[model samples]
Target: MKPTLRAALTSPFVVFTVFMLGKIYLSWFVIFESAFSWLPLLTGLPTVWAAFAPIELFARKRKLMLYMIVNVVFTSVYFAAIMYYKYFGVIVTYHALQQVGQVTEVKGSVFSLLHPYFLFIYTDIVLFGLLLTFRRTFRSWAVRGMTLNRAAAGLIFPLALMVSIFCMWTNRDSINEIKQAQHMGILNYELYAIFAKRSEPLLDESEITAEAIMKAKGLAANPSPNYWRAAEGKNIVVLQLEAFQNFLLGLSVDGQEITPNMNSLMKQNFYFPHIFQMVSQGNTSDAEYMLNTSFYVPPYGAAAQDYGDRALPSLPKEFRGIGYEALTFHTNDVVFWNREELYKALGFTRYYDKSFYGDADTVAFGASDEVLYDKTVTEMARLQGEGKRFYANIISMSGHHPFNLPDRKKKIELPDRFDDTLVGDYLTAQQYADYAIGQFIDKLKETGLWDQTVLFIYGDHMGLPIYSLSSKEHALMKDMLGRDYSYPDMLNIPLIIAGGGVTSPQVFPQIGGHVDFMPTIANLAGISLADHLHFGQDLLNTQHNLLPERYYLPSGSLINDTTIYVPGRGYADGVTYALPTGDGAMPSEDEYKRALELLHMSDSYVNQLPKHD
Candidate 1:
């Protein structure tokens, strides 16, 4: 070949080869981090480069620009949506963007934009910069001779290579940070996709039968069955208090309790004083799924919304089978979590939301707790008077985020601490809920229906941060609990079972989640649940421990006894000196392998459920 022709062919080839190598380097970096090992360095680099070589030939300036722009924009928008939903329980759209400026730093920008979801955007930006450099070099070469001299070229490629290697070295550390942040935010979509595709057998009849036998044998040994059996024919009412917490349970102003009604009710109810809710995907709706369906939320994606049509056995369904008029009442938009569809599928005969009752006097996201409770009580009485058994789930709205209540000065007095502040306002709302609940119960008593009614109340999720609160408010919480503030505690709302006939108040000690309510209540009411394999066990059943088993997408599967966190490959389990485990360490390899097998089995079971359906 001629010298000039040879150089022309070889120059682009050299740049293309370098670019290909860089791409290979990036892929290997991801693999290395994913594997949690340097093992990928030995095999992935050269193999990936060879596999990607053809794409290098087509790398042109225009093509590179388009690719960079698309990836950057796509990734940025994707991450922004994730973050927006994480903080506000809503997505960012063109209409939402218009209102973005109205929100404060903590509420909108700082809280939403600074989250780990933004890391994906940052990764996209880095990729864009790399693409731009390649594009600029190619453009310069196409117009004239390559701009970099032999010395510059030698320095540039080697420098790029070195930096690329350095990035690869640190990628694992970076991913660890990303994983922590991602877990705190919304569900991890990529992780869900991985496990969903791995086909495994669903829970077989033998397994369930064995588990049932174990549960039954254990239950027979307990004396609480009589209390549970006596709970029949009582009207069951569950109040899913949005963003409530035990902190609120103790919160008092000037020695006067904020939740006076709750305090009084606690004295008369079967309260699980230290009950911990085992959550799946972090969201109000997913909590509802866990609480109602007793099925595990697939750690990534919108499982509640995605599985809306899936046949899942629920408490309402069990109640309906026993001649009860099952109903669900929500203050917010029923369509928000696809609750309208999901509720009906779960066998709620009558569904009520903002549309059902006009939104003119609604508070926060929907109707005030007072109004919702008043209406629900009225409906419950109406149904009961008609000689029908009733199961009504009333979801409160006043305690939701941006915790604002409409101006209504009831007979109850607000404490001096509940001034015009966010936390104060939130407390005031809780007070309102307590008052409404108290009134509802009083009305039931007037009708002589109090003895025949069962009341269940718990929080939906944790409260969001109130920017207006002093650093001291945040500090008090952190000091009392040595961790970053979370919405989960707020989600850990008090669950009380109260009625005139509820015998003695006893605190159940096992760890139970929202999902447990269905099975627990159903079993107590002597209702059989068919077509659903629930992950939640009855808390009232003292035989089997309702262990908290969490499937954290992309990495870990945590059962109360063991936590298997695998950022990448072959797997390593260590023992820790934590409860469940004697030394707060991870399990041994043999233990880990066993745990992994169980997780795989669980995943297989979840995946196979739909096929059976």
Candidate 2:
């Protein structure tokens, strides 16, 4: 080897720079599928040097140790971004730190997302550790020492820092997080997110009214609404199935039904096939919050963590106001997602959690779905005996992620190819969940509570993420869905309203989201939302809707009646994916502005609400 080239390669600064650049490029490739662009290089250089500058300037000794530490930290950030993108299909920021406590609970699902190649990000760190173990060998090849001159260091440090800051400032307005990360570089973007403040002005509560929200959403009021107060004075039962998606409604594999009970329920009641999920970082808890309050989550964190401390207007409060008792049932601990505070904020009269269900037949977090429904029914019957009109929420957790149902609980058989695959496991789990639901229904009928109550069933969020699927699983989903599984399919979940009010069977094809659940249920329960502040319209009476997405998708993504539009940098460079109906609709700037304004209004209104003592 040439002496000059060998010396440069042996230098710690050059060696560390090479490793960081390689990892950065790898992250770009994994996320965007194209890393050849010069943007990452241009933005990455200054950002990386900015971190190196201070140590290079002031540190006179132990330079190698500091560099290695910094390198490991940067590598960790890049690795986290890659893993998070694979799991959530969005860039990771410091805001995710709030969810670190939840990682251990869902470790199975977290590990399932790991690919063998992703571990390469840590190869250099391992080798460095080993080399450090044998100091003589490491020093033999390592450079003796090196440092930038005082004057040179002073100039380079500030210049590099300024360049990085400039990159972040220019692209700060980009609504699509991925595009912003690409332009400013992942390192610069992460740093900017930690230090930056929102520049937009918050709208006053007075300016945020139902008329303004309706106008922004482009939805008109229905004078003679169908099914209004149809289930008046009846009991309300809501079933929130975890990780359940619409594709499982009538799916069959090898002539075996995936969710036969739900299919039958759909045939005998009101089924909404076009409802999409609107959960944020809190996942299931976010679904509950949106369903009860009919409001969007915070811009940066989960609603439970950010807004649960306030006294929010919700469906439960609406019921409680009319002398009806309100309660919720979940097998998990109430503290898992700050749900204790959330339940209080939602105004539930009572909540039965792990303490009420016990640890028997445990599934993901606590008791299995069978136990949840079994115990919940007993309590429901008790409430009925008390002559109480009640609102009861039951959340099912057996079909959660990493869908590994216990063999004793498994209710379906899979083909050889389907065995041991993520998709197969998911189907088997859903089948078991369906069986549990069947048992719950039979119990309700025997107790005669079925005819006296209004049962509402819906999915909490998506189970399978498109980016996390393998090629084989992708092919399997294509065969099941009749095409490649897209964003629309991932976001779509079923909403079935049965018993009391829904006497006739029918399917509603209008587009809606969890945000619309509050008003829809209020209307059917013969409750008035006139004095209450809610952002959702009654889905049974609406044909036009605009659903703005967050957390899972980009910032500017919106769903209309015909298609889901995802913005790149803005409306012009954005793309539209067809819904189940396959409509070729175009996106407009006016619609994009309206979607954003609605979100801002929601945030403003919720923020201005008075906190509970």
Candidate 3:
């Protein structure tokens, strides 16, 4: 072979090999401990190969620089948008810097563009872009390198084919196993490609149907004594409080209270101290999906966006069928997640958003909690006076990110010991929300609808990180939680169910998720849920045990419930707390296997949900 030709052929391959090794290294370092296997490497080969192809064409410094610049710009922007939406609940802006504490040079705005996370994301994008740009390079190398002899070509082709086939067959089970374990939507396309190549049959509809039916039967067999049976034709009001944390109950100023109304209301309500939300996606829309549909969000994308065009089962549809007029109110932009479309898909009769209210109603994102609550009550009364039972969803926005309010905002006094700028502001916002709820309840009572209404309230998710309370103010939270105070506290929120004239208050100890709310409410309202094989069980019924310690990430599943953190491959049980069998220990082989099965089942069921037509 000519030297130039040889170098041309080998250069791209070498770069490609280096890239793959990097991926393997990173995967091992980060994901491997979580039970991830080699499947990600194998499935990512096409993109990896494509990324290196560019090295042959744009091998020159000028071209490479241009390519790198373009790649970096796009990747940085894309990831920044994603991070902003995911963590901060808004678009990226100059003002975001003010929200984070300890902004050193490394954490500076310009530095954030080149942050490690952004580098990882950009690497993948650039790698894939190269692979796509260099298809001709591969074809040229393959043709020039192969022998002209027909017999030689025949022998080499079949040998290559046979080896490829053998490897695929050997790895088929492992690949399927990994795909089944992944819960993140971002990786689904690659996983689907692998399954398609192997010609593995997708999950069967009948299996899902059977699982749903069995779950329904089990639920019917064990009903909660506290379950509120449908009052033939009563109004139902659901208040989904955005970022309402249970810790707010402990918040105070100057030995006074922040959430006095919420604290008082809790005394009259059935509160679930350990109720967990099985949110499919980590956004507001995901919470809505779990609450309304009682179905897991497909791990790969936004359920609301994906199912916006498809028909799906919803709580409002059931309520409407039973003589209730259904409405949804969001004190924010209706178009935020295509929520207007989603509400229609969920069978809501009327949808109200910021556009429906006055300009003075505006809060941080949209309407103030006071304005939203008052408007909702007014609307409910109008509907009630029309001789119609109502099914209304009131989604609050005041307690959302930036946690800011007008300076004149009602201040809830807090103890001197609990004084901190951000935490104090956050507590004040919670107090404001609690005040709104109290006012709404009072309006219900005044209208004589308190006894005839069923009220359900829960947090959308955890409070956004309070930069002021970082390691300095919340040192104890970090010490006791074993995690940064930011992460775990963000996941803990309050869930309270009251009204329908229940005289006694009780606390539910079982861990339940938002998805469980739908079926539980449906059961109370005498509506049969369409899909019973959901990850969420009826929280009202405490017969089932708590959910295993599992965190479903966009990439894969983390089963941290057992003392060890078992990902997909092995156990890290000894790293944290030991398992019961104890050796200061690792998860038993059986425990790892069971965790794998549960993750697989969750993935399979979610992937196989009937796509809206």
Candidate 4:
């Protein structure tokens, strides 16, 4: 019955702004987990106005419809950002539109990320839809407008536009994308990204040589590189385990081993305990690209989507040049994540996907890891019988995310506390993956393929992202790891290189990334990368590395020998976290500069590569 309050609340301007502001608050809480602050509102208002102010400026009628459309659009953006951040720990941009198909394929993973509160973002739309059924109520609520005068519209339009542009321009150089979005507002940041030019010019093709890459990485030529040509002439086998992490190595659940086979392999081979996953939007495909090409993924999108057309210089290509048959095997369809084109670009002699694996024993995307290894081993045996020198890239799938393995595949027994949780599911799935790897290794041995093969096994990316963990799951992880699981632990993945004369049973503590795989393998296989322009150094030879990370972590993030430096705005305000070694030594500005330079060099070189026919 309060007429003045009801009238003010019914004003169209106040109604729309309130809805937007509430959505902004939810988005901020989900993304930043910060207490109430005026920054988002201050930065977000102008951008929000730019979207809706036009309706007031131009259209007199159908204003409600336009506002509704804009509201829906903004709400979707905020909701998407929230969902994406929960798993990825990064603000999603429009570049994510390219991943719409990929997202649909992983609906289980997407749905698992959804919270009931997240769905509340659409409550207003639902109410509005219900009101639409009653024309009188809809008109009374939506059309009861406090219309802005032409003079006010003229003033607000330019001022809001200028403010949005200013926000974008001022915050453009903030290398940390999350901080940039925070400072400039998420909506404005998305707009800025769409139109933003590359901050630095591309280097000339001649300037992007291997030597230049080495220099930028602070690594010089190694005259007598360690483990050089140790596996010269051996069959190359690369097994990319899906969503596996380093913490799983030797990890136990109440006296039972989690990855026994991998632990055994690590004990008898060259194991890298400090390699971090550097995948971007492409996830597994990004890891594949980085491992084979020694290149960073694209800045904003998946490598397979953005650079799959290029005939990339890769480990497979290098091996094929030396009279080896290079092939890749994945359980999923080749079209998923555009890996068909990606495999071709990497210069594989042949690739076997879902068609080869068949739909039988399917888990997440395709055939289970057991089936993948079983069939792949049979094929490898055939190749061996034919006396073919081969380079095989086998991608395991059973351990993919949403980690809910079928009961038949669940080999690990979870305690009551670990029941029905992501961490528990992840462990069981990875345990199954380990069992599959064990089977594959045995088959390799039985067929005499193990002794002759230069086997490289590594986790594709992280599985239990810290952002995806519930509080109980977080506590569980802390219990498992003996400490709070941090970014370094999240990004860390195991890299095991067995056979191929790498029987040293040594664990390399030197920091490395997926990008280091190619050079490291090339060295062991007697293949020279002197002519190859790669961003990563060989982990076997290099004692120090500055591994620049993307996607899951923020921009301007890098892993050095002693710490992971994550920038707040830029390096000045960045925080340093200890690696597993317990040294949180701050990275230098030079290292940070070189890390960025290395990324740029990779981008420039890859961008100039000849497109595949």
The TM-scores of all predictions, comma-separated, are 0.66, 0.97, 0.66, 0.97
Give the lDDT of residue 218 in candidate 1.
29
Give the per-residue lDDT of model 3 (tens digit) for 209-270. Answer: 53543342233445334455654466778889877876666555446676787777677778
What TM-score quantifies how close candidate 3 is to the native fold? 0.66
Q: Give the TM-score of candidate 4.
A: 0.97
Candidate 1 segments whose C-alpha is farther than 4 A from its true place = 1-71, 74-226, 253-256, 280-282, 404-429, 464-473, 479-491, 528-533, 543-546, 549-613
Give the per-residue lDDT digits (tens) of candidate 2, residues 273-362: 999988888999999999999999888878999999998988998899899999999999999889999999999999999999999998
Q: Which ten residues in a row have the lowest lDDT in candidate 2?
A: 139-148
Rank the models by lDDT, top first.
2, 4, 3, 1
Clashes (N, CA, C under 3 Å) per candidate: 19, 0, 22, 0
- C-alpha lDDT of all candidate models, in order: 0.53, 0.88, 0.56, 0.87
Worst 10 residues of 3 by lDDT: 181-190
What residue runs in model 3 are displaced by over 4 Å at the alpha carbon?
Answer: 1-61, 64-201, 210-220, 223-232, 413-424, 465-469, 476-489, 528-535, 546-613
Which wins on TM-score, candidate 3 or candidate 4? Answer: 4
Q: Quote the lDDT for 459 in model 4.
A: 91
Across residues 207-321, which tens digit of lDDT does each residue of candidate 4 receive? Answer: 8777777777777888999888899989989999999999999899899899999999989888889999999999999999998988898888899999999988888889889
Expressed as tens digits, the lDDT of each residue in 574-612 for candidate 1 is: 222233222345544544444344444444455554421
Candidate that beats the other on lDDT, 3 or 4, i.e. the better one: 4
